[model samples]
Structures are given as C-alpha cells and as structure tokens.
Target: MSETYYLHLNVSRFELSLNGSLGQSVNITNGSDPNAANIYPDISYSLLTVLLLIMIATVAGNGIVLIAFCASRRLKTPFNYYICNLALADFLVGIIAMPGFIVYNLFNEVWPAGTALCTIWMYFDWHMTFESAINLAAVSLDRYWSVRWPVSYKRHTSVKRTILILLATWLYMHIAFFPGYLYDRIVNVYGEHDCFWDLVMNRRFCTAVAVLGYYIPLSVMVFCNWSIGSMVVKRTNATAQDPDVAKKYAEGETRLTLAKDKARRQRQPLITLAMITVCAVICWAPWVIYFTIAPHYPTALPDILITVGYWMCYLNSTINPYLYIATSDDFRGAIRDLFCRRSGQTLSGAFSMIISAAPKRTSLETSVRRAS
Candidate 1:
C-alpha cells in the first residue's frame, strides 16, 4: 500500500506510483497524458538468488587470499607485497560492495540504508576499485623494472619504496574524492528517496576520477606489461639462439640456470595477469562507457549495463586466489600448507616432515649459481 504520484511532463501526465502501495506500477496510461511507473510485478527472485551466491563466493575467496597472505611468512617478499595490496583492495570491495549490492537486489533495488550508508558504500566502492587498479599498475611497473633492469631494480625497489607507493596510491584516491563527498548528496528520484551516489555539482567530477583512477592506470599497466613482455620475448628468443641456453646440463653440474629459466618459471604469473586484464576489460569497459555517456543520455539500457559491469568487477576478488594458485608455484605451495595445517595434518609436524625430507627441487645449475 503506497501512495501514487502523477507526474506531468510537458503535455503528457504519467502516474509514477500507485496509492497505498510501496511499489511503482507498470500500467502506464497515455490518453492526452503519459505516466511512468515502477512495474512492481516485475521483481525477479531468480536474480536475487544468483546475486547471493556471487556475494558469498566473492567475499569468501578474496578473504582467503588475504588471510593466506597475512598468515604465511614464506609468502612474504617484495613481489608478493604488491600482490598483497591488490588482494586487500579486492577483498575490501567484496566486504563493502557485495553485501550492500545483495541487499539492494533483495530489496528490489530500493535502498533502505539512509544517506550515511549510501555515502559510505559509494566511497568504499569507488575507493577500493581505484586502489585495485592503481596497485595493479604499480605491480606492472615493478615487474617491468625487475626484469628490464634487474640490477638497478634491486637497488631501488626495496620494501620501503613499495610501501611508500602503496600508501601514495591510497592517499591520492582519498584526496581526489574528498571534494565529491563533501558537496554531493544522493537525490532520490524514484520516490522512496532511495539514497545513491548521485551526480552532484557536475558529472565532470565522476568522469575525471574515472579516467584518472581507472583508465589512466589501466593504460599504464598495459604499457608496462607490453614492455616487460617484449623484453621477455626478446630475451627468450636470444636464449634460443644461444646454444648453451637450451642444452640440458648434468644434475651434478655446479652452474646456475636461474636467468635462463626465469621466463619459463614466470610464465604462469604472466598468464594470470593477462587473464586478469581481460576480465577487467570485460567487466569494466561497459560500465566505463556507460558512466561516460550516461550524463548526456539517460536510459534503462545504460543502467542495466552498469549493473552488469559492477557484478563482473566484483567477481575479480574471488577469482584472484584461484588464478594465483593456478599460475604461481609459490602461491600453490602456500595454499597446500594452509590446507594441510587445517586438515588434522600435524601442525608443525606435517610441515617439518615435508620440509626436512627434500628441499624444493632445483636443477644443479640453479643450485650452484644461487649458492655462488
């Protein structure tokens, strides 16, 4: 039972809501006047159920990635450090964004959470997303530097520099959003005054941030990946030309083939990153296009597209751990340890048995070179 309001639109009048009812109506009338309504009968439970599963998987998966990283000392390294940040961003988004989105879906897209929650949701949603994008871009730069100039990379890419970069990324996002949070207010155009991230002041702010926070960083990541990938390809091709590079050495040989094997060992991580990039593009491209174009034209398709993009983006969190395990040997080992410890496997005992038995197998060349 909600009150209905008739809207007058220059020569056409439309009923926006039905009286004594909490929902809008689809029975639009246009006899010398037209009215718009929220067809209440159109609510779909199927979609709601799907959203629930997505939320659960997304949050749980990302949560595990974060927890595993935090608890595992063996996983600690400069490379894993940035990955840890990326996981944090995605995990935070899952916690902050997914729950609210599920609620909104359950409630028929009607936001009952007052202005504060709405603001917080918008902030968290945008912040964590931006953080993920920039962190990935930072990671690309790190990998590029590490491979492109290994010696110099070691000199500059210390733990301190990594931390500073991560901190700066967060700080920059916060500062950029400060103005919008201060002056913006969600306008409830749908009658129930559902709080949302409204286009305040001008859509220019949104456009600006979207480019700076997402597009620009994404571009940077692409560039870095391209450069590093090219270097890897060139090095690998050159190695193919080097008769010794591909020759199988005796297991007892005291020479390190670490450099020669670097690309092969790193293939999985590169594949994982490539997959992530594809997912990001698929998930966010539509939303980015919608946001960029929506200000000029408002339509149901744009809104629907944006919703689709949002869920797709949300899926990233859960997929990261699986991707890591599938891509990186180190990450898989960490997962193995985590599972082993939990499954009645001897706490320190199981790990000790595994560790004391045989060290990770390395070619004789690699072992000797690293020792030297």
Candidate 2:
C-alpha cells in the first residue's frame, strides 16, 4: 500500500491526516471567531503604541549613556568600565531585542520570522539579558571591593584587568547559554515556527538557564551589597569618632563634618548598587519564578501573565540609564557636558565647572595609576 498525507485548512479549523489507508487524523479548532488568535484590534493598537514608545525610550536612554561615557574622560575609571559595558548590553537589547518583541506582541504572540531568524533572535535575547545580569553583579562586586578595601582595590583592579573581567563575563554568558541554542538547533521538534520558548517541554534546560542567569547572579549581588552596606556603617561610625581624620582631610572642619561628607560620598555608590539590585529583582525575579513554576502547571498560567513578565524584564533595560542619572552626579554631569559640547557650548567653561564640583579620585583609581 502506498502511504500519503493530507492537510486541510478552513476558516474555523485545521486538520491533518497521515496514512490514508490507516486513517490517522488530528484536528485543531480555530474556535467560533476568526479573530480568536488575535488580540482585540483596539487593544492591539494601544499596546503597539505603548511598546513602540518603550522601544524608543530604551534605545535613546542607553544611547545617551554610551555617548556620555565615551565623551567624558573623567568617567573612564575601572568601576565605570562595568557601567559602560552594562550600558552597551542594554543598548544592544534596545536595538536587537525590543523591536522584534514589539512585532511579536503586535502579531498576537506569533513568530513571523522563519526558523533561522527565530534562532538568532532567541540567542541574542538570552545573550543580552545574561550580559546585563552579569554586568550588574560585576558592578556590585566592584563597589564592594572599593568600599571594603579602598586602597588595594585600585592596585588590584587595573584597566587591563577590568577589560579582562568584562570579556570573561561576556564569554561565560555565551557558554552558559550555549546549551539552549544547541537544543533549539538540534532537538526542537515543533514544526510550527514560533519564537517563544516552550518552557513546559524544555523544563530542565530552562531551569538550568534560570539558575545560571538569574539566581546565581542575584545572590552574588545581594551578598556584595549587604557587605558593602555593613562596611559603610562601620566606617561612618569610626570616622565620626576620629577628630584626626578631619585634620587630615583639610576640607573638613570637624569630625562630624568629615563623617557626613564621607557618608555622603559612600552613600552615592551604595544607592547606585541598591537601585541596580532592586531593579533587577523587580524586573527579572517574577519572570524567573513564573517560568520555573509555570512549566509544572502549564495550562494554569495565563498568556497575559507571560506577556507581563516579558515586558517587565524589557523595562529593566529602559530603566537602568535613568538610575545612573538619578544616583550618579558624575554620570549626570558627563551627560550635561556631552550635550553642551554637542550643542556648540564652550567646553572649557563646562569642563571647569564639572571638574570643580566633582569629587576627588577614589583611592582605588589613585593606586591603579600609581601602579601603572
């Protein structure tokens, strides 16, 4: 007997038949409404507008951070190196991930791109996301070292070393995410062209990815920030009790004044770290938790919850640069100076004002330069 397959498509349903002799059939109903798979037209239009705005803001905000870092030589310290890289990762997310995501959402969760494009899209999606997470952890560790060790932090963390660490983080992320890519390329059996992850089917791999990309880095960041906070409190108390420290600074009139100034400087970096940690948790934790648990109860999770999780994670990229601007006078001043020069303002005057107001170089930087 000859074997044959038949495909059937109708306005309200889809069907497939294998082996005309054996008569195996599968039917999928398209439901009573033609627009069932699509979001409500008005809602779709509104969401499209909102997502477009988010995409634009993500790109513009991260672009400004990259530009500000590049334009200001003073911002080129080892710590800001991590910030620069984080900005770059977020910039890539804005450019590579956001637009496709917008299309995906607009199309009602359908993947318009073919398999090859889908694979590439998924790779970049994880790559940029993991890069941002690891970069945030790196920033937390850098701040911790600076606050805890101060003098030796500079000597140990040189520009070359920082570059090496950044490269390693990027490399590690690629390696960590390689298994998912490999699975998609080799083991994916789904004939339907879709860009979304099938978390229910790929439970083990997704769990591994979540642990490596989210939980591990989040733990590290929390630990480092906690240690840094403790150190800051101890240091502030010690400085408050030491009158000689005020005499040494020359700018401080009393121990209380010196302690307050030191606390202020220390608080800035901690605030920056805290914001990064909090945002990461707020944006990523829900997604991770949902994905990890949703695999076990696939039918119980709603489609809208998945969409919310994804967009919340995407919002992280949009919000990071603003955090830098809010917590960092240096970053703010750098952006201002960059804009001023771009708009044909006198650089000398702007630079002089910024330099006057800027804090002195950290002990880490001073030591790094001396060693160099």
Residues 1-372, candidate 1, lDDT per residue (tens digit)? 565644333211224433444355354564543433332335567986777777677677767777788888877877778878888888778778888877776665666566678778877887788777777787777787787888998887777888898898888777666566555553334334254555533476787777777788889888887887798789878867887654544343444466436646766556767666666666677767776676656663546786777777787766775676677777778877887777855667787887899867669979899999
Could you give me the TM-score of model 1 versus the true structure?
Answer: 0.75
Output the worst ten-in-a-row residue range by lDDT, candidate 2: 9-18
Q: CA shift at 208, candidate 2, in angstroms? A: 1.7
> Any runs in candidate 2 off by more than 4 Å, and if so which?
1-43, 243-263, 345-372
TM-score of candidate 2 to 2 decimals = 0.78
Clashes of each: 10, 0
lDDT of each: 0.70, 0.79
